[model samples]
Target: MNHEITELKFSVRFSDCDEYSRLKLSRLFQFTEEAALADAERNGYGLWNMMKAGVGCAITRMKLRLNHFAPLLGENLTVTTWAKENYKDKVIYKDYIIRDGQGNIMVEGTSSWLLVDLKTGKALPPSASPYPIPIIKEEALPEKLDILPIGFFPKKVDQVQGKNTDIDINHHVNHCRYVDWVLDALTKEEMKERGVRSIQLNYIHQVPLHEKVDILRFKDSKHHAVFFGMNAEDMKGNPLKARCHFQARVGFGE
Candidate 1:
């Protein structure tokens, strides 16, 4: 029995928030991702299950817009996810929406996922897929706008090494870690005062243990910023690792 749509309830744990008791941006993504995966797991396309079948799921791109800020510590939230039968890069496209207990949307986002071979790490053809994807009209977010790479902005760069804590079951840097690097670079004080209204990210390359990534940020003003960065060593002749385009708004979209 496959579900056309899956919804789950979660509580914001103590560890999910900052000193000010506000939920962190990266943690928000983590919760959303967790919900999506849990649903797929019940339908037989889960991480471990897929890996055993010689295929694995990985997110390639993500774009999120906030209608409101995340729930405070211990607040209950509802998260729903579904896949649209759209195929690109031999992968599936999924949409997500997170709401408070009142059913008012707090966050909405879309994501693209790839199915790759467990050993070779090459993407598999869509025809080879076994699970049935849902046909749902995705909830739309604002159109994407181009943001300049970090190299085109300020010169101050923050360097971070890929450590054990940074690695995930996929054996590379986890997706949430990338968001952490971005918000950390921007700082919590700034993020809280000027809440992030939206964020778009493209996963270009992976950061493995022992590798160093240079995170660069270019602030457009006190309330806006652009983040672009890449690994120190060139991968595939391109220094671009990942780029996060985000907007900072007032009062957490209230």
Candidate 2:
């Protein structure tokens, strides 16, 4: 609790695994989020404190690299996360590592977050927080995740409406649900043929509950695909008019 970094232990449950018994990417996201919240709470920037201060933290981007062998169901994992020392005013960088019981790295990730005013939803500087969480210099991924670019006519593969389960305390669709949507856009056969090697997400806007999201995808190559989540009207054949909720890049392996 006194350290800048926080580590928590978790056991992969049935719900956390996929058909292969390997941990789902979305579940891994949830675990990392839990670890992050724990770190913030211990550092005095918990939800109640932030709310009292009229500010809330929102994640803007995340990039994750998965090991060849993902964490399996029932495996014990240690999730460690820390906030990076801020050189900028408006954004915070955070890094994470998930290790198995055998001390092997299962997944590594980095994320960017912004402190926003609760009333106006405008981003605030780090100086505005009720408590300044201690930060470390360590970086999980030195390179920043880029914004995914799509072609002119990216195909609309599927559509999904935000459900109660997709909503979080922030009253919008949780970030992990977007991961699910991205994966769902691909077929089981495609996933089995091309295993997911890495994923990067850029969350552009909050998705309100019950809002229908159109999943559009551009397969750059046999091993890579970029996806965008937009509103129904936004996909009326114009990329320029698309009200993008999020953009993502999914990399696959042989």
Candidate 3:
């Protein structure tokens, strides 16, 4: 396996930024995911093709750290992503986001993913003799970290009827759309006026199309809100499918 670093460039769009003129926290993850997908494709390990061969990639967890905020709409940015190592049943990937022309680091993150059998959706064991994993190591976060957490519980459950487009080759909602749901729940005022500094998410369960889902919302603070997604049963009277905690700031200047 090649361990060379792969990089991609993207521009910040009006939709990518919040009212504070910086890229939205969720969109940053989307961009980084895109970069990883593209890199995987270039490496002949694209998710779609992998599924065709009976394997699929699923993100299990992610940790993001924001340094300088890229708050300008239409600003060009570059994302560098590469695989790091293989674990027992999963592989890890790391990414760096930098402002395009100025070459400033805006954010950096690491994600863990497992390869699963498409037919059963169960994790596959790493090959006894798997390919050599990359050795590029980035700085790790400190032990005492201010990792974000989901701040609210979900309520008002609704199921999303699976549509033909709902199923990816991986047989689940496309990853980015999860962010879309969170963004969709936000009002235009929220999207335009709020700033998100950092975020960390753990993908505990997969949501299928046509599954009943519960939407829950609560304000953690004047500037922050929490959202949750769960099955209808849980929405009505159980736990949540997934909980998201968002940290927001107001009146940020680009």
Winning candidate number (lDDT): 2
- Could you estimate the TM-score for every candidate? 0.83, 0.94, 0.71
The true-versus-predicted C-alpha distance at residue 243 of model 1, in Å, is 12
Query: 186, model 2: CA deviation in Å?
Result: 1.0
Arrange candidates by TM-score, highest first: which order?
Answer: 2, 1, 3
lDDT of 1 by residue, 57-114 (tens): 7787777778865568988888888876556537677888888888888888887777
> Which parts of model 2 have CA positions greater than 4 angstroms off?
237-239
Q: In terms of TM-score, which candidate is stronger, 1 or 2?
A: 2
Model 2, span 1-254: residue lDDT tens: 45657999999999889999988889888898999999899888988899988999999999888877567889999999999856478788899988899998878899988999999989889877878867888888886666766665578899998899899999999999899999998889867767888989999988999888888887577678889899876666785787999998888887
Query: How close is each model in CA RMSD to the real structure?
Result: 4.1, 1.7, 5.0
- Model 3 spans > 4 angstroms off: 14-26, 88-91, 128-135, 139-167, 184-194, 217-226, 237-254
What's the distance in Å from true for residue 12, model 3?
2.5
User: 77-167 in candidate 3: lDDT tens per residue?
Assistant: 8888776656543455554545555887777667677767767867775452123234455533421223335555434422344456756
